[model samples]
Target chain A: MKVVLHIWRQSRPSTSQDFGQDGKMVRYELDDVSADMSFLEMLDILNERLTAKGEEPVAFDHDCREGICGTCSLMINGRPHGPERGTTACQLHMRSFQDGSEIWIEPWRAKSFPVLRDLVVDRGAFDRVVQAGAFISVNTGAAVDANAMPVPKADADKAFDAATCIGCGACVAACKNASAMLFAGAKVSHFLHLPQGQAERDRRVLNLVETMDKEGFGNCTNQYECEAACPKEIPVRVIADMNREYNRARIKS
Target chain B: MNWMLDYWRSSIGGKVTMAITGLLLFGFLVGHLAGNLLLLSGPEAMNEYAAFLKSKGALLWVVRCGLLAVFVLHVITGIRLARENRNARPIAYARPDTIQASLASRSMVFTGLSTLVFVVYHLLHFTVGVTNPEHFTMETSAGGHNVYGMVTASFSVVGIALAYVAFQVVLFFHLAHGVQSLAHTLGLHHERFTPMIKTASVGVAALITGGNIFLVLSVLLGIVEVQS
Candidate 1:
């Protein structure tokens, strides 16, 4: 199928190379593209054409096309990763688009993740946030018997639900204010639900929120756009839980 | 105010403050709309309404103080939340671009700050009689003569009227988030009622903005004359 591609292109990161200023929407014409091909795979075809013509290939980030990696991030058209809910760029198929539709594709826009080359971003900030002890930090000794923990099924389910967050940075991309509360909440809530996590729950929420703030993400206005665009469908309720937990920690401190 | 100190210490406190102040502001909007609608009844009606409040003396003062406190808490908590949010993600993404936020949600902070400025200006111009000259005009009311004429005269100014309309629009956006957030903060948002709350917030914001615009226009257009 033939489609018009509006891609945001920048050669370098400088005041002169800013988006909308340095970026131009380059149009490409492709024929016989498979509808079943993933969105990133389609981009690869476009880049291949550009390279054949000795033109610079468009730079984008993608790995593990299975969508579990959460690295294949893009703002397809106006919605995140096309119009489908609970999906990533790599998971999105060409069949979602009309044959002749004009698709506007761009990278995630947030202050915390700056463009490295083209579509690639330094998501290491998220890793740093997690490293600031998003975990319980229990030493590995005799593996604690699973039955000894005796977590309720309800609590275990909630914790597992929160733990499903893959840290894709989609919540930040979807939020207009660039708020990371949804992402931070998932990380915070995942640990707070179990007894093993109880030991560091207070410190975890505090340190993570503090780190998130230090990272320059915007505040959650409770808009729920983050949830709407989250490929994992992590609910904003986790954010409320995070808020309640943070308040409790603040009082204890 | 000190009791509110505990509320400011945590996210829940912030959430509670957001909810309580949000509900108070909602109530204030209803009352404000009711008062402004008196303009549709002619100058005497509006003036009598204002005069009735003045006659309450200490009671009016108490109500005014309460509203002021609510407004202050709401703004302070909002600012604190925004600041903490900014702190959470200090790094800029390499290709960070957003295409999902609604205008109302995205402009919340901007609209909020603008509305704050408008609120102060409004109080100074009409309530405090600092910037508005017509606020000094006197007129006869049910209890006696008072400053009803001044309000009509003040509303007649195109500059003031336009400013009020613009501010009211900002207030609309603020309320959009405030009303919805209030429900979440209070744990009133559930699967069955979340959509209802969002719709209600939108309707309330529209009604408040619409009501204020009507009063401002009626006064400026001379549709209602102030009784002397």
Candidate 2:
């Protein structure tokens, strides 16, 4: 199959002012793309071709290529990943595109996730938000018995559902406001549903949310774009749960 | 006391503020619509209803003040949040697209501001009687501000009636997105209940729009008229 790609190309900016302004779209025509190839594999082919031609290869982040790592990030054709729901850019196959299609690819757009290079933005804001409180502080000792603290089946399911979040910025990317509420909400709800997460409940909600705001993310307006673009299909209900948790924590404190 | 202030300053706090105020304003809308519906019963009923509200004196003033406070807070917080949201993404998408976001969901600021303008126009036209002083002076047999006379006189002007209809369209979009958002901010969500909540949201929008539009069209079409 043949496809034309318009890819965003830019070198890292020395100052914040030069971030998005320095990038431009560079077009590449690929005639030998295989329908079975993963999106990342297709990129690899493009890179090999660029390398042989003594041109700079496109810079994009990817690891494990299996969609679990949350490293492969791209805004393919204006969507967080691509046209498919519940799928990441790497998991998307070339077969999704029609022959002779023209594709537009760019890095995730957000002030917090500035483009470091072509098609690669810094998502360290997510790590900082997690570090704020998205964890338990249990002592490192012998493993505790799982059944000792019996959790309700419903709570366990909700917790497990939230725990699947891959820390990807797709929610931020897809959101009109670039809000991280869904991501931070999932983290908050993941802990709120279990006994292990009870100790830091109030503190976690306050810290995680405050940190998210400090990182220059926008507030959620209940548009649900984040839920739709989420590669793991995290529900917007987690966000409502997070709101409940935040209000509860505020009142208690 | 300090915690309350702190809560108001946070992001979630901002949304909570908007949600609470929005709910109050929505309540006011329903009440206001119900009051206006008295116009269907004729000038006597509508004017008497207006006189009844005015009869409360101090209580009426208190309710008006409270409604004003809620309206001010809603607009202020909404504008501040929108500015921050715009700055959060300094760079715009080349080919911006939405997957599931409705036009109403995306254009809240525009629709909200349009409604705001319409609100001021409405207050000037009816409450202050500044827009049309001639019709504003229309008196009923009973001594009262003739709200029924004012509405009929205003709707008789085709331009004014059409403008009312257009603003109703804008208000409909704002209310549809806003009512559902209030539920989300208040943590009201369940898969089974969401369908109902959504239906109720759209239903409220449709009802308000339909009722208000019908009132204007009724006067324009002569279904209801000022008694000769």
Best by DockQ: 2
lDDT of 2 by residue, A130-197 (tens): 99999999989899987999999999999988999998799999999999999999999899999999
Q: Compute DockQ for each candidate against the true complex.
A: 0.27, 0.82
User: Each model's interface RMSD (Å)?
Assistant: 5.3, 0.8
lDDT per model vs. reference? 0.76, 0.91
Write the residue-wise lDDT of candidate 1 on B47-146 in tens digits.
6787788899999989989998998988998898877666443333333444444678768779888988988888787767789644554546444545
lDDT score, candidate 1: 0.76
Query: Model 2 lDDT vs. the true structure?
Result: 0.91
Q: Model 2: runs farther than 4 Å from truth?
A: none
lDDT tens digits by residue: candidate 1, A1-253:
8788877777775221343235555667777689989888899999999999999998888878887888877877756666788998899999999998888876666667766655666677789889886887778889877798789998898788889888888887777667777888899879778888988888988888778766767666787888989998888878877877776777687
Candidate 1 chain B least-lDDT 10 residues? B88-97
Model 2: which docking level applies? Answer: high
Candidate 1 chain A, which ten residues in sequence have the lowest lDDT sum?
A14-23
